[model samples]
Target: MSTSGRSRAAGPDETPAIGRPRDANRDVAILDATLLLLTEVGYDQLSMESIAARAGVAKTTIYRRYRDKVALVAAAVEYRSQSSPPAVGPGGLRGNLLTLVQWLAEQIAEQEIGLLGALFAGMRSDPGLAAEMRRILRRDEAAMTDQPLREAVKRGERLAPHAAELFAEVAPAVIVHRIVVAGETCDERFVEHLVDDILLPLLRGHPNKPARTERGTGSKGTRS
Candidate 1:
């Protein structure tokens, strides 16, 4: 979660003028500063001037890289997301999902509650930020589940229609609700319950049961 002293090359969209490369160290500094300020003061109170001062860069430097706070914050969020550990597990649908849920829980646990609250509030108040956040989440959801679902199909397991879309909403929603709204811990037991009791049932049509079909059978199937 801490991005201090970490540097990455600027993405294609962030490229600077010819022969004038963007400083990777400065990019890290600015993103780190933005995240820190966001946690402390929330999006409404954060200012470009404050970020520049905190990052030890000129205001124009930030403006040159990002058009405004919205773009800067989105970039910071994307950077943090990219920095997180990839969700990998043993080769099985259930095992992969368990790893994904655990990975998501760990990511959420690393964030400051104030930062979460700030983001929730900002989403309510700023349409642009909300859209950007949703887009980022959707992209991540696809990345996390694509392999597992595809592997399941290869194993002759039939997924309900729209299974990916349904799965994308369930685990994160429940985990975030438990931690952020119910103010409860998202421990191992909870993750297991969510996967075994809820998600598995929804996706596979029954707990611990694989959805398989006989050849040339016209059996009705469930949509995930």
Candidate 2:
């Protein structure tokens, strides 16, 4: 959940400028500063000056790299969410989903929930930030769900149409709703319940309603 210290190279849209290359050190510093400030003050209170002061760089330096705070904040969020692919379990779909849910729970734990809620609050007012959030989340959701389903298919399992979309929504929707609306943290147990009781059964195309299993029975639920 930590942001990488190595700065990314200029993106596709970056204009070719006839000058010294952008300083990688400054880029990391700026991003690091932005993340820290986000946790401290939330999104609305953040500004270019405060970020520059915290990062020990000039405001113009930040502007040269990012057009505005929305883009900068988006970049910071993307950086925070960077992680290796979720580990697939040997139990096929069920195992893979358990790993995926736990991984997401860990990521969510690292984030300051209030800070995230603040960002969500700004989504309506700032179309650019909202679009960026959607883009990143969609790309991430695809990666998270697609690989597991493909592996399951390889193992001779059947999958439902729209399964990927359905499974992808479960973790994020539940996690965010828990944090933002329900005012609860999604502990490991809740995440296990979500995967085993809800998501796994849905992907299996069972028509019967799910029954509540014993508290520690999630692992059992995955066993064939």
- The number of the candidate with the highest lDDT is 1
Ten residues in a row with the worst lDDT in model 2? 1-10
Which candidate has the highest TM-score of all? 1
TM-score of 2: 0.78
lDDT of 1 by residue, 1-224 (tens): 22221324342246537786668899889989998999999999999999999999999989878887888887887676544434455547766776777787877777788877787888888898898778777767777678888888888877777788888778778877888788888776677667766777778766465323221144222221
Q: How does candidate 2 score on lDDT? A: 0.72
The digit string of per-residue lDDT tens for model 2 on 19-99 reads 787778887888889878977887778899999999999998888878888888877776666675565677667668778
Kindly report which residue pairs in candidate 1 clash with one another.
160-224
TM-score of 1: 0.80
The C-alpha lDDT values of all candidates are: 0.73, 0.72
After superposition, the stretches of candidate 1 with alpha carbons farther than 4 Å from their true spots are 1-13, 83-91, 182-184, 206-224
Count of clashing pairs, candidate 1: 1
What would the TM-scores of all predictions be? 0.80, 0.78
